[model samples]
Target: MTIDTQSQRAEHSPLRRIFGSVFAILQTRLELIGIELAEEKDRLLGVLFLGLDAMMLATMALIALTALVAIAFWDTYRWQSLAGITVVYAIAALVCALKARNGLVNSPIVFEATLAEFEKDREIFRKP
Candidate 1:
């Protein structure tokens, strides 16, 4: 029996070439998108951590400053020192409370982006 290599190659050459090209493009696109998403996730986490660290440092600084000021005023008028410390604490607490509230407000934006990504992945997979 003669092997019909020429006929088989002719029938499949164009289709196989086109399919290989399409698959290569799709794979490249998927890899690029994954890398971008990873970078974005890293950046988001870094920002969140920085914000948290700043808030913590600010809180500590406020407390330390108030204590120092209170000690300085303690010999003159204990009431004045106590009042100053109280005001400092109040202001710091108010700021921290507002920041906590803002964090809650910003969470929805993050959730929306996450949900959108999930939807896109779902759609991609659902497509034949």
Candidate 2:
């Protein structure tokens, strides 16, 4: 009975070790995915807040400047001044929108490191 038990354990040991290694690798990959997700979320939030603040301040400034320009030209070129300001604001808005679209389209793939790590794991396991 003692000899049989020793043989059984010896036969199962390699399987157990393989399973342990696989589980460890899986756990590490999961941790890396979690970390990447957190970083991406923080970055997106920061960009959102900063963009909102910039838009808000820029709008306030534009409104104030528009009022000042209109008041300054109230006698002679009031209409032309307002129309020019409107045209300039429209062009600026279009440029900003295009830049934002390009930024989103060109942004790096999310979880790139996690994908690379998974690829490495696949390569490691594929070896003979």
Candidate 3:
């Protein structure tokens, strides 16, 4: 009887309860992190495929347009027309590169929600 009673008391001890609560919180946070990671992965893959498709189409259009422009000025100013087109393309490439750099630099942090949840947990634990 005494052994059974002690066992029951130990199972329902405050320390055990605290540990269980902490484990539950950790499990919930881990699940949240997993969900956020999956979402980010999906978003990144979508952007990657769309961006590649757009770039391919744009490159085809630009090539066709460049050929047309060069043919239009072939007899009179062939070299000059090609040079002008090359310069314009170079400038546009530079602008796009700069914008891409800025976008990467300014992009939101990954796992933002996970970090926030951890911070909240820290705050909760810090209180008496």
- State the lDDT of candidate 2 residue by residue for 50-127, as single tens digits: 989998999999999999999999999999999999999999999999999999899999989999999999999999
Model 1 ranges off by over 4 Å: 1-4, 65-128
CA lDDT, every model vs. true structure:
0.77, 0.97, 0.94
For residues 47-101, could you state the per-residue lDDT of candidate 1 as single tens digits? Answer: 9999899979988997788778778887888788788678867897799799989
Q: Please give, for residues 1-128, the per-residue lDDT of candidate 3 as tens digits.
A: 99999998987898888999999999999999899999999999999999899989989988998999999999999999999999999999899999999999999999899899899999999999
* Local error of candidate 3 at residue 47 (angstroms): 0.9
Worst 10 residues of 1 by lDDT: 108-117
Q: Cα lDDT for residue 46, model 2? A: 100
Evaluated with TM-score, which candidate comes out highest?
2
Model 3 spans > 4 angstroms off: 1-12
Please provide TM-scores, in order, for all candidate models, with all chains considered together.
Answer: 0.49, 0.92, 0.90
Candidate 2 segments exceeding 4 Å error:
none
Better of 1 and 3 by TM-score: 3
